[model samples]
Target: MPLLVTDYSWTQTDSTVYINVPLKGAKVGKVDILSTDEYVKVHFPPYLFEAFLFEPVDDDKSTAKVGNGVVLISLPKRTNKEWDHLMISTNDKEKKKVIRQQALLKYQDKLTSESRSKAEKKHAEKKYALETMMKLEKEERDTIQKMKDTEREKTTAELAAWQLNQKQKAEVETRVKLQRQRSRQTQIKAVTEEQENQCSGEGNVCKSEANCKKKQVVLPAPRLTGNIQVTFTPRVFPTALRESRVQEEEEWLKKQAEARHAVNADTEELKDLKEEHRNPDWLKDKGDKYFATGDYLSAVNAYNLAVRLNRKIPALYSNRAACHLKLGNFHKAIEDSSQALDLLTPPVAANAAARARASVRRGSAFCQLQLYAEGLQDYHAALKIEPHNIALQADIEKIRDIIQGTTADPDTQ
Candidate 1:
């Protein structure tokens, strides 16, 4: 016996690698596909096809499906790189072993038959064995597939029956609920009419009114007028006027004390405020240092100080936006980026660069927040500023694919 090799074809694109192998008489459970980051192997009977790629692939994203007399393998590339070649090497080593096993299984019984001579018996046995094996393999595959189909049909029928029963139950419950509601309304109307008839007589009233009147008590009117007069003397005064004058003096004293305390507190605060550093450049430098050290919170504080001192500096807002973006504060990043864009005086080279950086950071934050449309708009704006950046282009493409349910192939796009 000799080794056998089955011919196959493959194609590659920027994001995917596709391989199609013909399986004319293949059976389920007889075909196996093994894949890793660097290699792919397909084992089917006497054929064993292996491929070693030039670079790694995303094995988790790859898939293989057997249908239409073909095994189609789709490999998603880990990175957007072109494949120089399909496979590095191939091997087929199990041909003789498989043939010997089949021959022994099929011809062992025929070897003991007595009607025919050895040569003629051997020839007939070989032909019958091959045909019988093929037939058995086909029948086994058909039986397995038939069982799967039957199970699927059973599950579908059960689901449909369950849905129909739920619908009917809901309809019955709805009807019962409507009937109960109508019965309750009729009962209420009858009770209301009986109450009206009972209350129709001059001496009759509702029990609620009787209870309400029972809980209320009438109060008597005052007999004397509410009047009082006060006069001030040198040492003595009316009782009411003296008490009122004392209360006014105490309130004035308390307010004077509070005002003095507040003035003292303001004086101390003013001293601290006068001593506090107010240089915008120094604050921006402190923020830059904090950002470089990955202290985003501290950097944000420093940037806030700088912005308070000088609101016209666009770099302060853009730099702070980066820190906010890193900290997962997407709303703050958008606000800061919008501020940077607003503060830009004109579209000079430096201003354009700053705008592009702000836009990219804002776009990335928007994507993290799942606001794809706004993210796309910011990304397009960034692209216009830095049109030749490959990384930005790839990001735009990936974002588009994500928005489209991961179906848009980068190469095709």
Candidate 2:
């Protein structure tokens, strides 16, 4: 039972009544006030104040203000007359109980209505946000498609122009060749006529024939052949030959080249895929979208296709490992994480984050498999790459506690 508060004061006018209820150091947020035409109540945890109005007032026009550890309420009188007392001079328990019950029911109904309105508003907001996101995505896709179409049209026009130019060039070359052949034939005919006239005029057929034979086209001499030596700048590592790990660099280069051209186009699974679906990067993006939507199986399929298209992409393996982890395929997750780590070798600044992520994922898989030692090693490796990660540090401490038998088994909780 709450203590009844009698230390309240009130003032009245012909048209309004004002009541002030002391909070006794209670927080304003914790104070509850309920007002009606004939009754007013203030509840502050262990303290309660109630007033049965001497005469009915207009509750709709009443207002309450809480400040300075007190609540002040202004009530408008319905009859426009001064009240002799603020509360009714009666102690009828049954009437008080009925009024209290009515007030409680009215408060409960108001709370229910307000909560329903809030829930509806929240739902509407979420729906609008989702619709807006989808619209933006659609617009972006349409823009990309428009760009692709424009590029395709430009390329087609260029190709047609090139083909027409080539055809005209070929025709001109053919005409020039025919004209050269005719000029050579005319020169041969003139030479033959001159030889015949000389023979007839000299009346020496054998001599003339011998002279014509000597005059027959004299060919130029063949040019002397000689070797032309060529040399090229040496292709070597930036570091000195002695200081460089040539073997490792060569292996890395070889792996890079293989990765770039390793698409398995002849596979049965890929034979019926659409052109866009054939792209490894596109598949990876599709996988990411599926993962974001919580469709783990679809995400796995997308990642699987991307991996099959290009096994060298570390991100594909890493993302697939995440999906596997979500699906509770711990062994598969470890395998994918290991593959991602392998592909991210010869660690550089560009891949530092990737390496850390792969290590953490693999470590998680190890821990899930109950291999605490292995997990600890991978976690330590990740920490070395990302020492400033607070979450990672916390996780490491937890794992350590578990390993030392200082905490209960995680599975049990």
Best by TM-score: 2
Q: Which segments of model 2 are wrong by more than 4 Å? A: 12-17, 35-39, 53-63, 74-89, 192-413
Residue 412, candidate 2: C-alpha displacement in angstroms = 33
Could you estimate the TM-score for every candidate?
0.34, 0.45
Q: Give lDDT tens digits, candidate 1, residues 119-201.
A: 58798899999999999999977975786687788989999999999999999999998997798778767766665666665
Q: In lDDT terms, how accurate is model 1?
A: 0.74
Which pairs, if any, clash in model 1? none
